[model samples]
Structure formats: structure tokens, C-alpha cells
Target: MRTTKLIWTIVGAVTVVLLLAGVGIVAALRGGDDEPDPQAAPGPGAASALPAPPSATSPAPSPGADITGPLDLLVIGVDTRVSIPDWQPHADAIMVMHINEDLKSGYIYSLPRDLRVDVPAFDANGYGGGRRKLTEAMSSGAKVRGTDKADVAQGYELLAKTISDYTGVDGFDAGAILTFDGLSRLTDALGGVTLKIDQKVVSQHRRPDGTARKLRPGGGGYTGPQATYLPGTRTLTGWQAIDYARQRYTAGGDYTRQRHQRQLVRALLTKAMGAGLPADLTRAEAVLTALGDTLVVSGDRNAIEYAYALRDLDPSRLTLVGLPGDSVINNGRYIGEQLTPVGRGFLKAAAAGTPEAYLADHPKLINK
Candidate 1:
């Protein structure tokens, strides 16, 4: 009984971690661009790609093709550090949130950052296609000729195309870029997010004070007493949440980190919805204000419209999916990740707007 319980607990933790990478952001920014902030600087890699103001004339072509119903949104979490210029950022976490036609039920899953895929040719960023790790698509697409600055929006465009091709979807209805800095601010605005941990994780990146852990003299890993998170329910501050989400050195490595990230998403969404934040004008405004710094969104509808459309979406109804896969090591060289046949089939069902039907048969794929 004990062994069975532990196995299920781990499975549940992994399953719930990746849901709502975008939902939480959508819920938190429900107020949208009603009042723009001129003083707030755009997030790193956030440039002119932001949506233009509403116009009296016909709208231009959307950055991505719009889906009328059963939309798929590519949500990317980037480790965008502004401290270094000319540093092209990679998509640390890539997720697709599929909202069924009814908008009541949804499925969320992550594409391994190191997954091997053939990135399509994107002329906008001068990326001539080739097979590479999935994360490189964003780094290659974000580059601008004769400029050191990276365009995160362009990166997202290429990534969306890559994912669309990979999943056999026409195109994404919308997309969002979540930066580490923005996530922290959003969490703080919500007073802090509470999450359940099924296993103990020690931070290898940050100290207990949220500062960088020192490297050993020759440098293979950090040399210090690490910040430890024990198994239990814990409320994490903005930095703590981000730090926890960034941990990939645990037993499950990146997969474990992925689980924690989705868990963070679930926690954020729960806090945003249940805390009377929408009704509290002051807190709502604060959450919205923090959003400007948190997300770079692109879709036919603005942030407000997306939020409103999903307003009635029940967080409980969303399904957290775990795609099965294994690392690809070629000639003893660790290359990337690849989904098994079953995982690929699951993505097809998800793209076709029938994941629940598919999950009905393959119960193991459902994270819960």
C-alpha cells in the first residue's frame, strides 16, 4: 500500500506541474490594457513586437493564424537575463494549452526543450531550416541581422510554427512569453503562491537568500549549503517560486523541474481565481499592472479579451497531461529528447481537439 501510494503521488505531481503555464497569466491579467503604462520598461527581449493600439481601419495580418474554436496557445517561459546584452535567450519551457470548443475543459503539456525536431525555414529571422534541438528554434529565430538585440516575439513566431508543424495543427490561436522576472513580480502581487511538493528538492542555482550560489574553484557544480525544500505544503515568495521552478538538478532532472513548473502554474491560477482578486479593484489593478512586466502576448484578441473569454473556465476542469519520452543519446553523446510513439499519438489527438476522447482510452497519459 505504501509503495502504491508513493507511485501515484509522484505521477500526480508530475501530471499537474505543466498545466496553466498560460492560464494563470491570463487570469491574472484579466483587466488587460485598459490603461497603459508609459513609465514601465518592456521586459528583456520584448521590443516593438507588442501589439499596436486598436485602429479605425481594417486590422493587419495577425502574427499567428487565429483559430475560431478549440484554440491552442503556445506558452513559452524564457530565462531572459537583461544583465547581458547580445545574449540570445532560449525557450526554457515550451507548453501548449489546448482549450476545447466549450472552453470549460483544457489540456496542457510541455514539449521537451531538448526534443529533436526539424525547425522549418523562417525568413523573418533568416533561419534556414535544419534538424536541431527544439529549444534552438527560438534562439535562431530571435536573431536579427546586423543587430545585437534579440526579438523575442520573432522567436515565438518561429517556435509556434515549429510546434504547429510538429503537432499537425494549422496554427496557434494565441501565444505568450513568460519571463522569469515577470513571473516573480506577478507572484509577489498575488501575495505569494502556495504549492504542494511530493519530493524534496534542493536548489543548485540560488542560495537561501535568493542570491547565486558560488561555484567551486574548478567549477563543475556549486560549493555551498544549498537551499532545501522539503516535502509538504509551502507558500513561496516570488523569487522562491521562480527558483523552485528553475531547479532541474533533482532526481528526475528536467522532467522533475517541468513537473514543478506546471505545479507552480496551477498554484498561481488557484490563487488568482480564489482570492477575490477580480472583485477587489485595488488588487486586480495591481495584478494587471504587474502583468505588463510579466507577459508578452500575441493573438487575434488582446489580453483582456482572452481573459474574458476564459473567465468562466473552471480551473478544476483542466487536465494535466504527461507525455512519455526518453532522452536521446547518440554515440554516447546526450543529444536531446524524443517522444515515444504513444506520446506522438497523444499530441495528434490534442491538436485535433479530441484529447479527452483519446485520454478516455489511454488513462495512463492523464497526469491525474
Candidate 2:
């Protein structure tokens, strides 16, 4: 049987939004067959420790009602090893989703990982305020004194605050942390994603068979036969999808990677909404369990509940925004990235909830 509109209520707007950050809850709501079980909830404690919604004081909506928006959500993807004790993870990917008041459309944009900015002091970690790469905010904030384990939540808090300050946004209404492992599992859970590769890219980290390339002697870089992707539409497995999205050595550098990431999110959402997920009970269970294990959501409501509220959201309406930047240099050495004046203007417009207007004037910033 084909998935009906009812299942859409459970896989709604936030599904695409969360996909940008590698959070997977679509499988968590699936029933034994093609239809979704409305009563299903994500695994216990999947969402926790998040701030209340912007309208927390307002009367709560009745069951199955959509929530009002004009809200901002911050998403961070970190590549940290679980086996390594006291490991401090940096933000490998930082993206933001801004929802319009109409709740019908939204804008998604990425901040370059190497963008240099002022990271505020974190009392918990004794980090003094200083200029640093945007990626370092999370690592600096995650530091703990003595035997205290590294705190990812605290890291997220710092990263969100830094981004909010930089973008002129008052604050983020919701946030999520996506681990590297979760990303692979989520992609695999959906069977795979079919995306159009904009350009040819060669892997700098992996070999042809999807195994890790051997490290060069003395630790300069990986060495082996690399995987290469040609420009075209192709269905990618989890690892291939991630590797392709992570290519920064391409022509456009990090900007190209950012564009690919957004494209991957759109493809994943399109597949899920088209009822492309597996109908078998065993596969569905594995997807749900893997998603639950890797996702950490921060919001007033659980991810499943949030999905219901965003049910009317049309993923097709999302606009992918790219902020152009130039390399920051000092003493003839590249230090970091700095947004161009146009990029700054875009951020200002986004904070004012008028990104659509800004993009209309600066169509070049809109990613095709």
C-alpha cells in the first residue's frame, strides 16, 4: 500500500530541516507497513535539555495543530570518536534554518567552518574570549576541568550563542547535534539518496571500495587510490553520499561542499516524502533504532511532536542560501574565512525575516 497523507503529518516540515543536520526521525514513526502509526513516539529521551519555544507563554495548541513560526533553528554536525576519552569535538558543519511566519517556506544557509569570529568566554570551560575559527567554538566550549567528561550540550550552547551574535539573530528557537555515525546510519536507513552531483569530485579521505585510505608516513595526509565521482545524477550509499558531500578540495572549495550538503538534504527529503522507505518490519526497526541512537535533539517538544506541528510545511518550498566569502590572510598566510559584504547583508536580512526580499535583489546568493 502507498503511504497516505496521514503519514505526512508525522514526517512533515521539520523532516527536511532536521535532515540538513543529519537527524533522522522519519523511520522512528513508521508502522509495520507503509502507513505510519500516529501513536508512535521516538525512543525514550531522544529529545531533552532544550530551551522552551518562543511562544511558551502562549496557550498550547490543541492536538495535531501546527505551530506558529518566524523561528530560527541551529544545527551542528560533529565528528568525534566515542572511544577516545575527554575528546573535544569541533563543529564540522554549521547550518541554520529560518522559518517564515507563514510557515509555508524557509531558507537554509551555511556558515563556513573556517570563518573567523569572536568566540565568547565560557565560564564552564575557562575559555577566554578570543578571535578564532567558527569551528573552534564547539571545541572550546566542550572543554572540562579535571575528570569531567566533555559536554556536547555545553559546546552546542556556545556555538549557538556565537552564531546568534554573528548573524544579529536574537537567539535560536531550537537546535540539534548530529554525530558522524548518525549521518551514515540515517542515510543507509532510507536505503540511499539519489542526488545530482554538480561537479566531478575526488575523495581525499577514502579509497575506491569505501575503506579508509592509509595515512602517509609522518602524518601529512592519506595515501592510496581515491574514489572519484563524476558530475551527474546517481544513487549514493551512506558512505558515498557523505564522502561526496564532504569534498572541500573541489573547484569551489568549502562553498561547493556546502551546496552539495544542501542538495543531499533535499534529495533525502524528496525520497522520504515519496514513500521510498522500506516497508519491511525488520528494516524499519533497524532504521528507527539507529536514528534514535545517533540523534540528540534540543527543543521544547520532542522531535516527533515537532514534526506534527510542522506537518503543513512543504519541503519543496525551501530555498538554499549560500553566503560567499573570501580567505582572510595575514603576513601572506591564509588564516580563515570572512564573509563578503553581500554575505553580511544576507545575514542581516535573514535576521529581519526578509531573506526572500534580500535574495530577490541578490539572486546570485541563491543556490540553484
Candidate 3:
């Protein structure tokens, strides 16, 4: 009897061990099936052992028409002020951006703020007739019409009509204008850009208490105010780079400022396509959102296609042209001188994508 009992006890122990082993195997299998492989889902927080699916859609790239045709973009920058009612938002900058679809080259035609032109009436006979600064079109419309929104829209329309009338670019549509605001946001989106400062520039900021806050100069010059100086070719944070671009009061004044703005844009493009920078999906999303608000992209598919074709463009091929200096006339009164006939011709060529022909016709305005 004792031997039989001992044998049964041993058998029971063996059964228990087998049961545990079976349970362990089942658990292992379930865990394997439940946990997804980290390598398979590499998205945000995936590196931290968290499983996340990558975003399905990327931001729509700039649009274009033919991959090898000439494209023109009208870029407008508005300067907003709190005071002066609704008409205070005026276009401080205007640029005709031309892209060579085939060569992947680009150029910016900067229109002078003081360029004189026939100011179109936004409303019916609000002002009988007048010639004024090109920049005043928006403000005049807003102030005179007493409807800021309508005036702003009319302002853009007038500008488009003027370009079309002068250049004869058949499709110079009013809807092609692209506008943006808040330089800080733009700079932040680009991570940081490199800028080459040809000369030393200093800008002073005024404090609320009437004290002057002077930014100290730094070596290599400075990309932004933090460094206080950005010299030749160096990398700069977004804010710093924006400051450089917006430095209008520098010794070189508006001309230098416009050139810097172009340079800053090129730098941003370079960094965007470069290596070493982390793939910042969040920042990219923010940028897209901001652009949506700031840019008034035309609905034209051709314009969209042209933007896409510029993806592989070389920055060096991009040229910058200031409005002809001689075309500017200060009458010492309200009326400003008109854009030079050569300058107007350049605009015509740019709009038509025949810059070479335009240059041949007006050699004097071409940058040597």
C-alpha cells in the first residue's frame, strides 16, 4: 500500500510540471501574436518601444504645370498695423517669382515700394482719379471704400490687372497671388538656414519704456539677433535668419534688405533639402498650416505644377533683380515717379517667361 501511494504522488508531481510547461508555452505564443514588431512600425514614438503608424499623407508640394516650362508667381507681403483702422494692412513687399521649368532655375523681380503707377479706384468714383505709390493701392482701397475686406480683395485684383495690362501675359490671373505673414513661424519651420552677409548691419529695437535696446554685434556677423552678428556664410537659426532678412534700416536700406530676403529664401530651401537635420514631421505640419493661412495660392493647376517642378532646383541659378533705380522719381510731393519703361518691360518678360528676350530688349536694366 505504501509503495502504491508513493508512486501516485510522483505521478501527480509530473502532471503538475507538464501543466505548468503547457501554460508557459501558451502564454509565449499569445504574447508573440499580440505584440507587433517595432521594426515594422517606425513612426513617431516608435523608437521608444511605442507602436505608431506613419502619417499616410504628406504635405502637397508646390504646384506646377509643365515640368519644363516657364512659371511665374506673384508673391505679396502685407504689413499690418494695429492703429489706422482696417486700411492699415498694406502690402509692404511685392515680388514676381519666375521659375525655369526645364533648367530648374528661378529669379525674383523685386518691385520697389515707391514705384509710381495709376491707382485704380476700388469703388465707383470714391476718388475721381489719382497716381500714387504702388504700395498704396491696398491702403487706398481700404480707406476709401470703408470696407477693408472688399478693398483688400480689390487691391489684389487691381495689381493683377495692372500686370496683365502692362505685360500682356495672357494668363496673368488675379488668383495667382501668394501672400504670407509672421516671419518667426516661417523660420522656425525651416529648422535653421544659412546666410552670407556681405556687409555689417546693425538694427536697433525700441523698448516700451522709451529705452533703446541695441543688439550687440557678433562674429561671422550674425544670422539673428541672438548671435548679434552674422558674418559671411554661416548657419543661422530661423529667427536670426528672419531678422537678417527683415533688416531694412541697415546702411544699404531697402535694396540690401530685398537681396537678403532672397538669400534667406535660398538658404531655407538648401537646408530643407540637406542632410543631418532630423525629419521633423511636427514642425513641417506647423509650417503647412501657417502657409495655408498666409499664402493665397491660386487655384490654377499650372501654377501648382510649376511649384512642384522647382523641387530639384539649384539655388545658385536663382537671380535677384531690384527695380531700376533710375526709374524711381521723388517729386518731393505726394506723387512718386513711375517705374522705368525698362523695368516695366522686365516685368512683361518675367510674366511671359521670356526674360532673355526682355534682357536683350532692355540691356541697361540687366544686372551685369
Candidate 4:
């Protein structure tokens, strides 16, 4: 009887252990499948520390074979006054980057910010609201629908939805909304990219006389702040490059400025991949670390795939095409306003994975 009792006790103990193990396994699976409960409220440091929240409306990741192929990314630069008090918050910068599966070739279609479109807003029912200025969706929504704060993430989502409505491109996700300051960190990470300012562009700095100090032209080796000022085909430091990209007060206004920004991007990509820089992994790590906090990205998988896809694109293959000159209305009110029809064509071309027609129609500005 004693032996039988002991046998039963051992069996009971084994069952308990197995039950606990099963419970743990079930918990792990549930955690993996479930999204974080939005009602759970983030901790004190969570707001600033966390990356932009994942798109609630984003589609599920594609299967392995479908992951590769042509991918379109809508990269939006949000100009929030609260974020940058010096500049007005506008959706002035828009680029649709198309990356092919082979990663050997890619194209960037830079859209004019003022191109009037039926700006889509996010309604309470999770649908889109009617049109307005492309830039106003975020600022206005933050004022009305949101808590009157600069919510860039929501703004991005609205833009993505609007683009989707205009262009029938399904699956093209809004990858990221990088602020202007983020450019500084990105350039720094690449160990300061080189850009040739092809014109005599003047940049004013703060002078001791309560005035601004101007930077004169010529090919000069520039890094950091000074690098940002040099114009017309010359090496520039990270900050300088960003400043060069941000300058819209040039003779051609925002249109010219957009061209310059695209040029700088091409130059930077060329420098980073060229044999000119030393193979210092430490510096690269530092640059990425500095940019880690400032840079905003969408899905991690998407970013990783894009990096791989763009690995083989040569500088020559990189076609930087601004919107057509005819599409722009240089009125006294808005210097670089984009016409809706032309803007629609540009977006459609971008969505269709071909922008050569648009580029062919637009004349390249002589690098000043």
C-alpha cells in the first residue's frame, strides 16, 4: 500500500511540472502573436524614447518570395514649427524612392511641396477626410483631431493614405517621416558625405555685429558647419551638406533648392561607396549611434530590405529628377507652386516604377 501511494504521488508531481511548462509555452506564443495593448499606457520615458508607433493600418509582411521585387517608399520630410522654430512646418520635401530587387538600379522622384492635391485627412472612423494643402494634414489635424500637438506620425499616415487614393499603388507603404535635423545625424554616420556645390551659393552665419556672416564661393574642403555652406561641386561636411539641402531662398526658390538637395544626396551616396574613405568601422558605428535617436524609420524589415536593395546602385545609375518646370507656377505668392495635373503624373510614374518619362520632360538645371 505504501509503495502504491508513493507511485501515485510521483505521478502527480510530474503532471504538475508538465502543466507549468505548457502554460509557459502558451504564454510565449500569445506574446509573440498579440500587439501591445494600446490602453496599457506607456511609461514615463516611453513617449520620447520609443520609435514611431507601427501603422495600425499597415498590411502584413509578404511571403519570402514576394518580399523581393520592385518596392516603392514614400519618404516624407515633415516641417513642424514646434520641432524647428526657425522654419515653418510644411510638407515641402517629398521623394518617392523606387528600389528594384537586384538593387543594381534605383530612382528618386522629388515632388514639389506646393503641388495642390486633395489632401486626405484621417477621420474618426479610421477613414480618410477630404482634401487640403498637402502640408496642412498634420498641423491641422494636430490642432483639431489630435491634442493640438505636433504629431508627425499621424501626419505621415494621412499622407500615405492620400497618396494611395491618388495613385492606385497598393502595398506601397509610408516608410519614414525624417525631420530636417535627422539629416545631420545621417551624414555624420556616413563619416560626412562629399557633395559638390555646382554654383556660387551664399550662406549667412551669425556675425559679432548682430548681423549675418556670409560664406563666399569656390571649391573648398568643408566639414560640419562650414561644409554646409559651400556651393557648386565641392566636398561638404555633414552639417554643411544638410544646410545646403535645406536652403530654399536661392534664386530659383524651392525648385532650385530641391535640385540641390537631390544633387547632394547623389554626391553623398557616391562618396560613401567610393574607395576614397578609409575602412574605419568605429567611425561608422559612431555615426549610426548619433543618428539612432534622431532618425525615424518605419518597419525594421522594410529598412533592412531597402539597404540591401540599394547596395549595388552605382552613382551613374542614380537618376535625380525634379518635377517638370512647366508643372511649377512661379507666381509672386508662391515661388515654386506645383500644378496638380503634373504632380499627379509624377506620382503615377513613381507608382508605376518608371519616372524616366517625367525626367525626360524636365530639363536639368546647369549646376551653378
Q: What are the C-alpha RMSDs, in order, of all predicted structures?
A: 13.0, 11.0, 22.1, 18.9
The clash numbers for all candidates, in the given order, read 3, 0, 18, 15
Ranking by lDDT: 2, 1, 4, 3
lDDT of 2 at 55: 32
* Candidate 1 residue spans exceeding 4 A from truth: 1-68, 291-299
Candidate 3: which stretches are off by over 4 Å?
1-68, 101-103, 123-129, 142-151, 166-181, 204-231, 275-283, 289-309, 327-345, 348-353, 357-368
Clashes by residue pair, model 1: 17-262, 17-263, 18-262
* lDDT tens per residue, model 2, 202-313: 9998898999899899998899999999988899998898889888999999999888877776676666555423234454455556566444444445545545455445
For all candidates in order, the CA lDDT equals 0.69, 0.71, 0.49, 0.49
TM-scores vs. true structure, each candidate: 0.79, 0.81, 0.62, 0.63
Kindly list the per-residue Cα lDDT of model 4 for residues 74-170, writing each as its tens digit: 6566666564543334565666556555545666666566655576645732435654555655444444342334455555556665555655556
**Which candidate gets the maximum TM-score versus the true structure?**
2
User: lDDT: which is higher, 2 or 3?
Assistant: 2
Candidate with top lDDT is 2
TM-score of 2: 0.81
**If both were scored by TM-score, which would come out higher, candidate 2 or candidate 3?**
2
181-250: candidate 1 lDDT, tens digit per residue: 7677778877888888778889987888888889889979987767788888999998898888888888
**1, model 3: CA deviation in Å?**
99
Where is the poorest 10-residue window by lDDT in model 4? 1-10
